[model samples]
Structure formats: C-alpha cells, structure tokens
Target: AGVDDGSRLRLRGEGEAGPPGSQPGDLYIFIRVAPDEIFQRQEYDVYCRLNLSFSQAALGADIEVPLLNNESKIIKVKAATQSGEMMRITGAGIPHVRGNGRGDQIIQMMVETPKKLNKKQKAIFQELAEIEGNPIKETLKGFFQKLKR
Candidate 1:
C-alpha cells in the first residue's frame, strides 16, 4: 500500500507499543487576551471626573482621590480664582503602553453652595452684596463697548 510520509505508519511488528500498537500525536493551541474595564488600553491618554467641595474650590487644597489599585492619593489642586475654572493634574491618568508616555488627570472646578445658609452666613452675604455694588452690570457694559470698538 502506498502511504504518504506525513501520514502515520503502523508496524505490526513494532515492539513495546502499548500492548496493541497505538500512537499519539502532538497538539497545539492559541490564546487571546480579553478586554478589561478597570484598565483602558490606549495609545494617547485617558480622562476622568473629579468632584470638589465649596471650600476646596474657593481655597486651593490637597485632597485624596481614588485610584485603580484601591489606593488613595493626595493631589494638590489650585483654587479657582473665578467661577467655572478647570484644573488639570498632569500624568495622573491611566497607564500608557511601553513606548508611549502616560496620560493626565483633568479636575474640573465646580462651586457647590450650601442648600441653606445660617443666620450669620446670610448676614455676611448681605453685607458683601451691599459692598459689591452691581459690578457685573458695569463689567458687562465695558465688555460690550470694547466689542463695539
């Protein structure tokens, strides 16, 4: 009989062959990695949201924030001089690939006021309101005049 070289050849006269002349071939396998939620695989950068307190936003403070490895870290954030300011914490984002550099952490400043003010607080605010003297209207008028020119 003509048998190909790649095919298995059985010899009836083979000695010490598992009692009845049996054979086994080698096996091969491949594996793949699954996506992870905690770790984001990216080339460039990663972003996340960070909340701040009223006092924290008013006066710059160092506060602890949560990270991936269940560890807390204190990141110093500069206080917002004006309302609606954003603070960026550099190189505090997700891990990067081997060749590329790491990402950054963006912390947005949100001024949160108290729901109910105490009597002393209200009185202080009233005094401040009286002292400010409608600066917003004057500022807007100046801005519009500058825009016209």
Candidate 2:
C-alpha cells in the first residue's frame, strides 16, 4: 500500500478493470534495494570502509574504490590522513529507482596500526617514533600545560 525509500510511482489504468466499461485500477510499485557486503545503504547514500597502510596514509596515495555498478573509481588519499575520517565521492553511489539523481558514496578510513613487526621494521619504527617524539603527548602537551594554570 505504501512506498519504501524511493519516490512513489502511480501507474494510471495499469490494473485490471472492475467491469467492461468501469474505470481500471492503478498499479503502485515500490523498489527495495538489497544490502551489500561492501557497501551499506542509508536512504540513497552508500557508505563503505577503507583501510590504508601506515605508509600509504602518511605518504598519500590514489587507490581504486569499488562502486555499486561493478565499477571502480580512483580515490585520492591526502598525506597524513587519519583513521575515522570520512571522504565523499559524489554520484558514485546507488541511483534513485525513480529519479535521475544518484547518491554519494561515503568512505570511512582506517589507518592500520603496525602489528608483529619484523626485526628490521621494528627497529625502523622505533627510530621513527623517537624522532616523532610522543605523537599524542607532543600534540597535547601545550594544551595540557594550559590546564595547569
């Protein structure tokens, strides 16, 4: 009786007629889009998670992002990209069943933390950490110092 997310469509005289000369009934159609593993739909928008390596995130990269139509798009990752930040790709999402407009794709970034690093990798990371100087504390040190006053 009611429509779902998309625009409602009413087809006049598309249904069976009541009598030989009586007015025909109207056909109401609704579209239901199924859930996808790679993308989650919210209304018409699509959202997906994307993981990036430490180097890829810090150095920036352009990777192929998959879309709903069996297509992939090149998404640009800015340098120093952080986890939990969202990027948007316009018009790359599911199209409205009744309208000509298409939704946008939202990409949630996840910067993978290094785990079980090899001997060489551990050494390099340790050296880099030392050079970076307590990334979190260094950033908050000045702010925390203000709290003392």
Candidate 3:
C-alpha cells in the first residue's frame, strides 16, 4: 500500500510468523518521500513554480507544465496575470492511495522581465510604454537618452 511520509506501511502476516496456525505480527516501513526538483509535496497535494515572460504574462498563454506521470498539463494563463499569482488545477495532483480522487495542482507564477534588451527590443518596449500612456515610460526614455550622452 502507498504511504505518506512519516507514515508506516504495514505488512500484515509478513512479520515474524507466530506459532503455527497463529497470526503473525505486523511489519512496518517508514515512508520517506525524497525531495524532487520539479514538485513540492504536502501529503498528496503537489505544488510547482512556473516562470513566464513579461509578454506571456501580459498577453496570456497556455503553458505546458510537466507532471509526475511524465505527462503535461496545459495551464491557461489569463491576460494581465501578475507575478506571484497562483493557479489551481483540480484533480491534477498526487493520487490518494485510499481515496478515489487526487489533490489539486497548485501553480505559483513568476513573471520574468528581460535582463537584456537589444536595440530593436528596446524600441518595441518603448513603443509599448508609450501606448500604455505610462508617465514612467517617458522618464525611462530620458534616462536611456542620457546614457547615450
């Protein structure tokens, strides 16, 4: 039977056999779930952190997330989804040993800003900033121009 961490897996009649015809004592195994790189576990629930690019988060996307079963789940990321936001996929977590259903898959989002921008990329972003009518965009433009001086 599947067991959770710190829980004992019982082996009935597999222990020291009692006197002939008598029931044997039980054997127990301590279950320790090793740490994994992709998933964090709590009981049967599973959690993961996913990174999205600035445009992906802002424009929305369907991301393919790896699963424990070697499968992938497509998560629908809503437009304007912010960093650190969470999306829960029902019945996408670890399967319960005794229960009929599984836990939910919790996705923690991280919006990634580009660390380097090419000239064309910078211009595109500047245009986007202007389109957004953000005052900081103008300030940023002046800052970049000042760097050229």
Candidate 4:
C-alpha cells in the first residue's frame, strides 16, 4: 500500500502483491534534528558571542572557545581590536542542504572588565596615574582657562 500523509493503515494484496495473495506495504519514518543553543542558524551563517577578559583584549591572546558541538577550539584574535569585531571560524557551522556548502561561524568579541578592585590594585592604579603625570588637574585647569578666554 502507498504511504499516507496522516492516515495509518495496511492494505493487504495492494502493495508489491506477491503469490497472488501475500504482499508488503511501504513503511515511512520521520526524523527531526535538534536545535543547538550555542549556534544560531542564520540565512547562510552562524553567530555567537565570545567573551574575553580585559587583559586578553588589550594584550591579544589565544583563547580557548567552545563550539556548538560542546568541543573546545582555539581562536586567535587581535588584542587592540574594538568590541563587536567578528572573527570567522571556517567550516564550523551547521550542515548545508542541497550541497550549498556549510555555513561559517561568526564570533563577536566581548570584553569583560573586572568587577572589584582591592586596596593594592587601587594603589597600583594611583602609582600609574603619577607615572602618567596626573593629567586630570591639568585638564581641568585648561577648561577654566578656556572659559576665562
């Protein structure tokens, strides 16, 4: 018997009829692919966020990032690049249909800053300020001078 789109039934002696009495019908099976959380399926590409530390963003480091398959991959990025810069990971996207070719992985860079600073860390920052010539006071003085002008 022919496969029905919704109906479920068996027609005897109607499909591949054999020996004038015995016959076999066609059996259909449906399969579905699960959606991945880490990979977003776009028109022809995938995009995801890759978080980096402040130091990592400043000093450029090779970070170990996670792929959609729950595997770790190393990707190198420029340390001085701006946030939201895209890094393409070749051949790391969803499988293509009709041989159109697989998609690419787009990684959006995100910089994470430190939340808290300890006393020693603050002292170090103050020392850096002194070394940098403490431009804050000079900047304010310049502003007042411009107003007077």
lDDT leader: 3
* Of candidates 2 and 1, the better by TM-score: 2
> What are the runs in model 3 whose C-alpha is more than 4 Å off?
12-27, 130-149
- lDDT, candidate 4, at 132: 87
Clash pairs, candidate 4, are none
For residues 15-77, what per-residue lDDT tens digits would candidate 4 score against the true structure?
A: 654565656655444433455666665755778888887668878998887776678798887
- lDDT per residue for candidate 3 within 26-138, as digits (tens), equals 98888887878988887777889999999999999999998778899888999999999999888888888886988877999999999999999888888887788863334
TM-score of each: 0.48, 0.67, 0.73, 0.59
lDDT of 2 by residue, 31-107 (tens): 76565689887767889999999988999999888988888989899999999999999888767878688889999
Across residues 1-99, which tens digit of lDDT does each residue of candidate 1 receive? 112223443444343435345654333333333544443333333334456666677677887765544776787767663445655556666555454
Say which candidate scores most in TM-score. 3
Which prediction has more favorable TM-score, 1 or 3?
Answer: 3
Better of 1 and 2 by lDDT: 2
How many residue pairs clash (N, CA or C atoms closer than 3 angstroms) in each of the candidate models, in the order given?
Answer: 0, 0, 0, 0
